[model samples]
Target: MSVLPDPGASRAVLVGTSQYEHLEQLPAVSNNVQALADLLRGPLSLQLPDRHVTAVENPVAAHAVLGELRRAATEASDTLIVYFAGHGLVDAQDQLVLALPHTEFGRIETGLPYDWVRQVLLLDSRAERHVVILDCCYSGLALGRMSAGTGLADQAAVEGSFLLAAAAETRTALAPVGETYTAFTGALLEALRQGIPSGPALVDLGTLYRHLRLTMEARGHPVPQARDRNSAARVALGRNHANLPAWPVAAAAVADAPAGPDERPWPDPRAIRTVTGFLTALADVRVVSGLTQKAVSGRSAGSMTAGTVGRLLNRPDLPATWGTTAVYLSACGVPDEQITHWQAAWQRLRTQSAPAEAARPAATRDGGSGKPRVWQRPMSTFRRRRDH
Candidate 1:
């Protein structure tokens, strides 16, 4: 199970604007901010100290919010969390801006540019991990910018950072009438309070995101979108209260439970010698994990990406680096022991391919140097090792 952040070393900032001078007011935004602060500080969740959690209500200027974030960023050595609940505006360039209490619709200069938040988290912060949650319309753009276009490799995303948005790129967040909080934040509060049943011992951000996505989809609301770059996916925000002691066994026991329909205990790595066989084995690990490519990438801790995972899995070729395979397996919940075995196998294949490539004719090696020579295990050996 994932451990909670140390209260002493972690800092959180919650900013909300419930009242706007010229635009529509969101009274629920204030509620959202307060409730979340309580959860983060209370025993139910992270249980952080009151001094560590800062809640700014109805800030009149952008600097007020940024100042809080900057302070927390410097003070925190473990984790830093920044949350915003208010109207989200776009600048002339369609960049995200957090609307303040005095900001007007047409006059976006009065609002706080989302980049201020991003830059501080990306460049200014000293914390080991970051979690930024935005509650507003068109917030998915923030997540989109966190990564370059998905590709096989060279995805330079920030490590140990996770961003969750209340709405997708094109949709607007909802604040239902008579509700104490906005739709997005209300569901979040519910998840933190009630917990997910039969979930892991602690409620991780990835698991929490999954629950929110399902809840929003069922309610016909704008489903929240998330981007997790590294170890942030495993950060446990709170204990799973709904997962009671009715099953008093260890957390490891749950993981060792019978496989779901999508999972299988695949063949051993020692039997895989060819690129196709290695790829096939990797795909099997993914099936056992039952996580989406995006989810797997989200937890890879800067190793592989969703596009990279998809590209490598679907292709007949092997990965460009061991980092790709290692992260994929780690993110998919494969044991470190198994991963070490797989790594040896992958290295053995690479070693074999180098010699074969050198020996191959120029035409066979794809212009003599560009393509990797595919590895193949003898048919007799493969037959002897076939799974039952």
Candidate 2:
């Protein structure tokens, strides 16, 4: 007798919305949603079984679209519903709203909350598997105001649903500004494209999270997060699992992994000297994030150039002529709030310094303080001094 595959296996719905009436209002967000949808239908298609994917694009009918999701959830064997890319807003009651086209304004007003999705997944106890991936901002807005540690149900009820939201309540979910992609959805695509499948061969969720954080940092964006009952899921990996995509991190990009007690070697004294000089000069220079005129002058401090500093701080590398004002503010330490404060401080310093910089007369005089005000001076001489 032939062995039958597991009875209930797979089905999915992918929803993407790009066009919005108020293009000026939320163009970036809409565009990102569309891009993520394209990826889901194309390169990421391998994950799901053929033809099991249903995509609804730019639907004018919100109720009908949601009804379809409901139908898919109820009718499919093992279902995964992915809503990739959209801007979400919370109502006065803090309920999350998934936007539809203009016609369904009334329904949107009383739209389904995120918990509704969770409840749908949890209700069917007989279903072997369910996954909901929501890639939108203010995602937690609909999930209720309960703190992170709060139980899924406010009344301490247990639910089997596994949820993966793109970001925490505090972090702003970013839309692709230009070439960039939405941090949340972008990370998801990268994970699906490159994550490891451990057991019988499903893509490993833990590894995906690890890659997501690392990729976001490299792309000059805040990392999206993941929360779920993964350990309890005990998802089995099937054989001949998907392979990771090729992503290159330049040799210079690697930061030595944090040292363990036994493995830790003393950092090179020269690097320490370089870091000290850079920090001292960096403290004096100010760099603002959105400001147009605030330029970062890449001068030499330690081994890193001013350009390197600008890139490190996510600032533009201005000419060395910008003087001390060009120092990009990227404080290196723990406590992220402190880093943000320093970043703001740098901007203010840059603003204060810009005028004084213009006021300074052009060079007609000799040896007036060889210091360029910014630390762009070459480190060759400094190296010599350190050697001595």
Against the true structure, candidate 1 reaches a TM-score of 0.59
Clash count for each candidate, listed in order shown = 0, 10
RMSD of each: 19.3, 22.9
> Per-residue alpha-carbon lDDT of model 2 for 1-388, expressed as tens digits?
1011121234456665455453223344454554544544442322333354567666665555666566666655533444644545454555555554342233444344555555555674334455555555443232211112222223211244334555444344345445355566666655555444441123334445555667766875555555545341333211112432122222222223254332211111121112222232232223112111212222223434555554543432223333333233321211234344444544544565567667765431232664433343468865665486
Query: What are the lDDT figures for the candidates, one per model?
Result: 0.72, 0.41
lDDT of candidate model 2 versus the reference? 0.41
Q: Give each model a TM-score.
A: 0.59, 0.46
Cα miss at 56, model 1 (Å)? 0.6
Top candidate on lDDT is: 1
Flag regions of model 2 displaced more than 4 Å: 1-8, 22-50, 103-112, 124-126, 139-158, 168-173, 195-202, 218-220, 230-388
Runs of candidate 1 exceeding 4 Å displacement: 139-159, 169-173, 246-388
lDDT tens digits, residues 1-388, model 1? 3546656578899999888786666788888988999999775787676899999999979889888888999888878888888777666766677878888766777888887777888888998888878777532233111111121011212457877777543433367666888888999999889989767757888999999999989997767777887768887787777863433233244357676552224335865545655765676566545567876776776677789889878875666578778878877777777889999988888887887778866535554364433345566655665542
